[model samples]
Target: MMNNGADLEQCKRLIETSLGWGDAATWTNEDFDTLSDRIFEKTSVRLSISTLKRIWGKVRYDSSPTTATLNALARYAGFEGWRDFMATTQPPAKPSPAHEAPPAPQKSPTRRFITPLIIITITFAVLISFISARIIHPPAANLPLRFDHRATSDELPNSVVFDYDATPMHPKTVMIQQAWDPKRREKVDPYGKQHTSIYYYPGYFRSKLIVDGELKMQSDVFIPTKGWKAIIIGDPLPIYLSAAETTLDSGRLSINAATLQAKTGSPVFNSKWTGFFDVHQFAGISGDHFLLRTTVRNTSTVEQCLCRNVSITVMGKLSAIIFPLTDRGCISDIGLYTGFTGVSGKDHDLSAFGCDFSQWQQIVCAQKDQTLDMWLNGRLIYTKPGNRSIGDIVGIRIGFEGTGEIKEATLQGGGVPQDLLKQP
Candidate 1:
């Protein structure tokens, strides 16, 4: 029951294990709050958010231990000390019909094996072999959790997952997909109600339908983690809307798990995401391709984060904010502007027919601060009123390299697919 090294290790281990980490590495109080929130979802522990954060602060650069902190965890774990606690690998059992009554227990001589543990004053100079070990090799219990994992692009034969960047999906009886764009959020009440004002702007070029001439715009795709992966679309729009899945408008793009790992902090070139996916020919673009150019947001928060063991659920309503592209693609490497950059070109090359060359109004969003210049054969045809935006673009492809980072994506209508982000 008294303070000891073993108890400290166990407390550290508890936190680490709860967060799916092998050891209790240095963490600020806020980090612990986030960690506990993640763990509490899967368990029925009545933990106050504030209390866990305080406990985290105790181990985070705490050179001195307080009596109150130790007593709290000891009581919560229903244990006398750290050593006695770490010994419980599984959760204790509950009432069962098989055991109508309990049997008497007896003690053995093995109890003498217990050893006294040492507790050193908090000091950077103290040996931290355990801490180092955790960072180097975390225990198996600490690995992150997953719902599912679909391996190959070929898995979506009959029904599709709407995962990668290709489409014309083999007509499936049913399909599921996951979609969580920050922009797609909406406000709802417990009884199921929503209230919001999220609008998508029109840019200059829609899909191949609006772009007139034969185009092969290359794209720069950014991967959150590097690995070989691909994206695919699953909606039966070709049948329902009688439109090509891809156009100058939107489509899907898939990346590899290996590709994700390799492009850490960088982006890759994906031709499929450059413009629209021709639903008619999309199925034939590539063997198991991945990429989708739907109404997706491409941006990230400037504030860096320190979150782990996190999951979000929306049993009620949600809300989101969307920034449409107007002026230019990007103001800088990370800033935002309307897609309005001016580059001199060889003038209009509108040879292909079914064209409306007179006006090139906004094809994307048309918010108030900026306007974008539509270019064909390098020449500007239409200049929509641009409203400066704060996020990147789902970008239109020209010769210059491009990249995409979804800032906000949401469902406008229809029963949104459920497998949009299911881990495969």
Candidate 2:
């Protein structure tokens, strides 16, 4: 759970990244509605539109979000939970005093004399009160809090049960957090012995039991994947596309535009392409040692627009590599989270991909022992060392903001590099 003002600010940034919005002020009511739908689609948890607006500062609310809300948002952003996101991701650097302007020039003579005299009088009064308080009472002991949790089954959609003990010296509130999302939270009897919750998705989840506003007990829960699944984030509702629906095109797996329109009854712009590769199909091997190569291009010939934006995600058990390609100057709008580095958004320069996107572009991203390296058109584009562990290779997803085509794509596990870009 977040413990300070800085934590709240960081949480807001995490939410913005997850929703693909660069800033809080940029979020609209429609955006919040879409977020509400997306969260339910991905996590099976419902965060009300009003609550989301309040959390994102879109609406005036007197109170901050509950711990449950934070956990849910964190999980949506590819963290074990909110606590994991905060503990692992580094917050933005604070502005240094050296970089700030110096204090204003000294005040006039009469103002200066009066300010010093007032300061001296306050200091004398504070000193006298401090000595009197010390003589009257002694220092107090720290508050005591205890919590422990367990799951009914170490599987997907498992139920987690918690047991906790907290000593409240004063009148304080007590609640249990199932995940970082507020909807997953509930107020429990302060003296109660246990509480339970159900988790629908597979990932590393950090659970917390809170007393008052502070987190008292915490633990992690891991749910393994069963197999590969395809999801189409379409308008009106999301459809679960099946492997049987995909066609093999010159050694690549893709869904045709006519098939997409037939299935969704909508245009390609209303659809979001997402596919997950089950570990079981690849000999059930899971780890950070994996490589993904895919070629994509916009095939839409609509007279109104020629450029189509695309993004590919290498989904690991605990993290993901988001590679976004679009017309020059549009990459900054993409949100990517690497387990090692913190979340990257509009503030980060992603101009490496700002170029013509109509033609097929080859992208290769590899991860060996948590160190991720990427190449575009056989040219090394970026590399970064990871600070955290890459839990497992859950799958990968290819998507287009409007409409696009996939030429070829493959996932390799613990294998020698291949000349993927060789002409077909």
Candidate 3:
């Protein structure tokens, strides 16, 4: 990916510029795809995702860029940035000692010894005082408190604007907040459904939701005398069919198939369809796994009738900490091959394939009264607990496993209405 030194510099600059806009942790492979392709299209050398990561590493360490790298970097930015960066980062080389006249150097051994002794005595006195202090005044009942404040890369003044990407998991709307500046805010999918915040701290960056005066999702900081921490309240629960309001902070909602997105008051995140996955019925640890059923109304001019059962692939994750995110395909880019799928081994291999994450998540589809379990090929794999919890889900998908489709469809969930599932 690093060809000419200049090309490398240009790529690095572009990446830094882009990272300046959003959360670096939330970066997607698609972003790299776009950046690399654009660089190649404009210039000749190409950069890969791995290459981009390496450049970021350099920036983290305050390293200098070579001449060739700088020139290429200049291509991606305004003249001012590239020019200023080059001038500021590069330093003038020092002349070799050999090129200058040699000077006679002498030092007094007695003076050196006296100075060293004086400094050593002072250091010893300070150490003695510290030890005495410790002995006389021990720590309180609780240990001394320490707080880890991570810094984020968000700029000084925060900004917000419309997101016009046709992608699936991005915010239809946005909420920009900066500690220093007045929020530069705008709403795009005021009708589409959610907002996102790229929160910048001094050390780490978090792309989360800001309290829309409307969604009032707020949390309290319960820092004790021992330590300090703030719980995130303006946050949605983990992605579950049972996602409910932790409190009355209006913005809490599942970012799945059933909820209507009011962009103006959209929470913090939404589905950015990077690709698709199957959601179906199956048997499980909880019981009849997921109830897979959907009623497809003829929205198209022709007869809108599906024929096969929707295939649901469940990936296993130990922790759902990074469970729901904007970067969808980053976790399973290649083959999704674990957990449970389709049906197990009764009549047919009703089974589809599955993938697993370090975190845990259950994918199910069902209604209030009815239940649906997993079937791979035709074999029953798992049956889930409860009913179809996917909020107001109307449309179910099946293309995640190569080229699959939901054949039979019916919407009978006790959640929200079925018609709300259409793409806005």
Best by lDDT: 2
The superposed Cα distance between candidate 2 and the true structure at residue 372, in angstroms, equals: 2.7
Better of 1 and 3 by lDDT: 3
TM-score of 2: 0.49
In model 2, which regions exceed 4 Å deviation? 1-204, 218-226, 234-238, 247-252, 255-289, 296-307, 342-345, 354-358, 369-371, 385-388, 402-424
Cα lDDT of model 3 by residue, 1-424, tens digit: 2334564455555556654747555565445545554454333346554455555552253445554444444544433345665565558677798887567566589887998999999999999999996776554333321111222323322222212222222224433222212232334342343343443111112122232211112111111111111112123321211224111134311122123123213332222111122222212312222234321111111111112111232221110000111012232322222222112223333223232222222333432343334332233344333322322222223221111112243323232234323314
What C-alpha lDDT values do all the predictions have? 0.28, 0.63, 0.32
Please give the clash total of every predicted structure, in order: 102, 10, 93
Query: Candidate 1: lDDT of 378?
Result: 26
- Model 1 whole-model lDDT (C-alpha atoms): 0.28
Query: Which stretches of candidate 1 lie above 4 Å from their native place?
Result: 3-5, 17-25, 57-424
TM-score of candidate 1 against the unseen true structure: 0.19
Best by TM-score: 2
lDDT of 1 by residue, 1-424 (tens): 4344555656656656645644334554435544553333223233454556545455254443454455445434445533456455336677688876777566455543432222333343355776776667566355531112222222112121111211111111111112222222222221221122211111211111001111112121121211112222112211111123222243333222233323333333322122211111122222111122223322221121111000111110111112123213221211122222211112322222112212221122222224423222223333435322323222222110122222222212112123322323
- RMSD, candidate 3, Å: 19.0
Ranking by lDDT: 2, 3, 1
- Using TM-score as the measure, what is the rank order of every candidate, best first? 2, 3, 1
